[model samples]
Target: MASLSVGVACVLLVLCMVVPSLAAVYTVGDTSGWTTGIDYSTWTEGKTFKVGDTLVFKYPTFHTVDEVSSSDYSTCTVGNAIRSDNSGSTTVTLKAAGTHYFICGVVGHCGNGMKLAVKVESSSSTTATTTTTNPDFSYSSSNRSSFAAYFITWVALIVILVINVSLWQEF
Candidate 1:
């Protein structure tokens, strides 16, 4: 019984660690206007951002997403600048946790209040499960989601076996 408890505990621990490391993707721009841009006035921060999360900047016009300081505009230090030239997509990974300020690097753009700010909080130790539902589950499609379900089932079986072994050890 002791062995079984240990095994189950290990399985649970592994699941607890693996689930949160799964990175999430966030959109910085959409059809209406630039998200996390000067025109938007403000950008969603903190909880919306994670350590390994990627911020995708998608905009049509020439704009820059620069990380700057909140206190001083002249102290503008660029951290991650995404120009519209890079295939219309720039992905930035959040590495550190703190309040980050950004703005357009275009001439006269930042001056016109094209600045944005965001606060990145430290990652939580607990893992949270993320569920994504496919509204259109096509039976004919050979997509990643279809395969993922099978993979998850297989993993679950392995976990169950581990738990059983641990339980048997207790006896």
Candidate 2:
């Protein structure tokens, strides 16, 4: 019935409103990626990192991504690394709120400024995320479909409500 369709549309509208937006994906070092000679500090400056955001490190086979402690990061020591990835294309998710340190495991790479230190927040503010666009980084293209679906669902809900109201008046 028309009433059933309206009810389903209303439910979809609520779901669209309640569901949190997808987390953002940031390309580390931008076009430079995780490599030597690049100023990782400058790249991360002024950028707000939050839990659930992803860091994609694209590099060559000779380099490696090593997650280390703050002390190890300062000393460029790979002996005590917490995690090491040599896949060249590494994706790391920010799972917790705190300072995270990453360095290149290859000798002298970290010393040459191939290291990064990011302070991630627990969660981003939900109030200002209706459109979910980050000024610092480009959003994922896949998220566009989600936003489009949300908009269509919202409009359908409004139309359904209007039709239901008019039908009520006729009875």
Please provide TM-scores, in order, for all candidate models, with all chains considered together. 0.49, 0.66
Q: Number of clashing pairs, model 1? A: 7
Worst 10 residues of 2 by lDDT: 130-139
Please write out the lDDT profile of model 1 over residues 77-124, one tens digit for every residue. Answer: 343343222234445565555544556666666666656554455567
The RMSD (Cα, Å) of candidate 1 is: 10.9
Model 2 misplacement above 4 A? 1-20, 124-171
Over 25-113, each residue of candidate 2 has an lDDT whose tens digit, in order, gives: 67899998888889998898888888777788888989988888888999999767787877778777777677788899998899999
Clashing pairs for model 1 are: 1-170, 1-171, 2-170, 3-166, 4-166, 4-167, 68-101
lDDT of each: 0.52, 0.75
Which one wins on TM-score? 2
TM for candidate 2 is: 0.66
